[model samples]
Target: MTSVVEHDTSDQFSPATSPAPEATSEPAGRDGDGRAARSRVPALRTFLATAALVACAAAGGTYVVTQRLADAAFVSLEDAVLTADALPVGSTGAGVVTEVLVTEQARVAAGQELARVRLAEDPAQATRGPRTETLKAPMPGTVSRIDIAVGGVAGAGEPIITMYDHTELSFEAKATEEQLRDLRLGMAARVTGPGLGRPVSATLDHVKPRVGADPLLDAPLTEEQKVAHERLTVVLVPGTGDVDAVSALVPGLRYTAEVDTRTAVGRIPAVNSAG
Candidate 1:
């Protein structure tokens, strides 16, 4: 037994060897494919982000252009004045004013006595007393101006008072012929002034051709006169809203008017022709 153990001693003294581990190719390949897919995700996200930014920029540009076009379609006139129906009170015969029954800014009705006048005594007819006459308003209106005082001599056809119909309110403006071409009846408008707390809605009533030269010009004619001479008188009436506010405005008050040409563009043939 001792001799048999000695025979395997040299083999036992050598190093012991174990089997090698197997390579995991399948898991490595799967991990490589997953990494490739993850790398593509960032590129796809970047592409989508770029596309969205471009769309937003395009939409903004379109809105700006549309706004500019809308603004360009409108026309504005700054030289506008409020006006009303005016009637002048005049004497028929030469006389002296004896008494003034109506005061300034007094509301009166038709046939209401405003003043009394005494005719000059005739030297030829000594027995006749001074002929007295009473002056009455021809129409219903407010007394705007009183030109004669008590005991003041008034000639025939001389104006003693001026009355205005406040109910008939209108806005008058002057525009060049070229500008008038773009305007039409029934077009929407907005009137603004220092007296008006907010813009008053209005509509175009008339566009009349001005006769003779331009009344607004005081200086000599220049190159500007040629184009400005043929002006159109534009009249605008209050809309369906509170017209009382517009009527309260004093005549001759300055205001700015903005005409909405958008609706008039297609509805009115003249506007299209001008364009």
Candidate 2:
């Protein structure tokens, strides 16, 4: 009777067996690779952003450099020609020129005798002899032209010789109104041309009051054209140097002038000192 009752006691008393846990479904290395690729996306984005920033900075730097260079002063070269101040020498009294002492292109000093004029003898007073007078150069210069020849009669105060002062040598240049704005008195200049053994030094001296078309033009022009062609005349005097050397450059010789526009700015200090 006890054996029959013990039938299902083992099933009730034995420890219950838990069902085995289900296996997780996943691909090999897929999760790690996906995590790695996702992490690298942020780094790649950061690198691209940094490169853009650098490119922007370089472009900005280049623009700033170009602006500075554009503001710097520049040397300007202009066409010019050598010229001089002229002085006329004339006879003080009316008479016939008997002897000519100086010829054209000859250099003379102040008060130097240039010619001798003999006054006509008075017929009413036969006893009076012809009065001889000497003509003298008014200033030191070179004879540029001769008006009267030997034995030619000249009137009183008539200019017989045209002379150019050796000390008044200058260079004349023509420029537009805009170009003249950059020039000023006392600015340094360098001149060069044919037969000029070396570059000559000069200084800006004068700016003429009149502004008009070139006086040497041969053709006529309309008013509008003339206004367009108007230019200012600039005069430059010789700088400190040998006077004879400067005088060697004759008038009407073509030359070029390099004008320094740095007078207002870009001047070097007299000395560079550190305290």
Candidate 3:
């Protein structure tokens, strides 16, 4: 059975080739969609930018309105100064200053000796030598001024040194009677000035009873107007725990003050009482 096997050599002779994938043409809308998306990018960015600008403008307008309302709620003082409760250190007795232990602006502790004085010899007294008197600081404070130098004569009860307590710092401002009516004790205040790092928070402390002639009243006026031109002093102390504001302030430094007169402190109480 060795019969000749007629193998299909024709199939083997045929070239091995595949039908080219039917020429895939992208959807006609695909290119148009891509171009449309690319064109929209700039418009989208521009829309976003316009939206952001509108939001910023609204915020700026709101801020301006808020600032105006805040200003309306306050009583302003153009002339204000940082100050403290001052103490005059005086000579205990008439004497000539023999030694000065401290200079101006010196920090002194309570009962610290500031100077020594040689008392004048009393002719009535049997003492042969002049008594030496020691001048001491009455409180812990900074020496503001030295009125007498070594060898200068100081009278009894005369101020030899002027000092102020730093812890008692306050802003002193001049206001008229009408402005005083709007203010109350414990009202909040804001202080701004050249030396301050930022606006300081304070509290209205008191209104000094003494009225002084207004230094700014330079224009000629009738006697009645002059009488009405008296200026009143208002004091504001630093808010509690604001030590940085107090430390940054130096006494006698000029500043501007704004007192919040619309606070509920005085108004609520008055309304309740009336009701």
Candidate 4:
């Protein structure tokens, strides 16, 4: 019994060793995910580039079409100016300018006293005393010029002052024969210039044939050629009772006029050139 107990005691006392763990696949899975994310980036960039190109192309095409349409429907003139009738203020008879009540460029109302004139004494009958006559404004306007000064002699019916009515302003322009053919009386127009808050809406009031010298023609033009190439004067008046437009206008101020050719008002009839 003693010999049997001694056998295998060392093996029984030894501790047990555990098995090794299996290799993990998590690192490989992360590598695959990284590759997938990198592959998607180029595709997203390509899509954005394509969208941008399409937008730019559309915008360019739209601009070209819009410009062509505008060119077809409008006629423009750059040599335009604000114009009005010049009202003359005159003295009734020959006299000496005694006093000037208003200065040049001053605004005067209708029938306002503008100046005083002393009548000249008759040479044959020296009995009459010096008569002073007060001159009045003919209409409400801005005084543009003062022709007579104090102590100056004025002739009968002489213009002592010149004025302009601001309310009756007009847009005037000179156009060639070809350009005038595209426009007609009563056509709609727009005038724009510096200090004008917005484009003033207007209507073509007059289209008159005006005699003009063509300085560009170095050689004398034939009578027939002159008749064919005669220039025209176009006048446009702003909308009636438009105080803002009238107030914004100044005489001799430059402006641009755009005439709408698409409107039916005063449309020119087409003529056949064929014989």
Model 1 stretches with alpha carbons more than 4 Å out: 1-56, 123-126, 212-220, 240-242, 264-275
- lDDT for 213 in candidate 4 is 52
Q: lDDT, candidate 4, residue 131?
A: 77
Model 3 earns a TM-score of 0.68
Give one digit per residue, the lDDT tens place, for model 2 in 67-166: 7654444334466877887777666667898888999878899999988888776688669788888878877888877888888998887877778987
Question: Each prediction's TM-score against the native?
Answer: 0.70, 0.61, 0.68, 0.72
Tell me how far the alpha carbon of residue 258 in candidate 4 is from the true structure, in angstroms, after superposition: 1.7
> Candidate 1: which pairs clash?
none
Which has the better TM-score: candidate 1, or candidate 2?
A: 1
lDDT of residue 104 for candidate 1: 82
Least lDDT summed over 10 consecutive residues: which range in candidate 3?
266-275
lDDT of each: 0.80, 0.73, 0.78, 0.77
By summed lDDT, the worst window of 10 consecutive residues in model 1 runs over 266-275
Q: What is the TM-score (0 to 1) of candidate 4?
A: 0.72
Clash counts per candidate, in order, are 0, 0, 0, 0
lDDT of 4 by residue, 164-206 (tens): 8877888888666677777766788888888787788888777
User: Which predicted model would earn the best TM-score?
Assistant: 4
Model 2 Cα shift for residue 272 (angstroms) = 35
Indicate the residue-level lDDT of 196 in model 2. Answer: 76
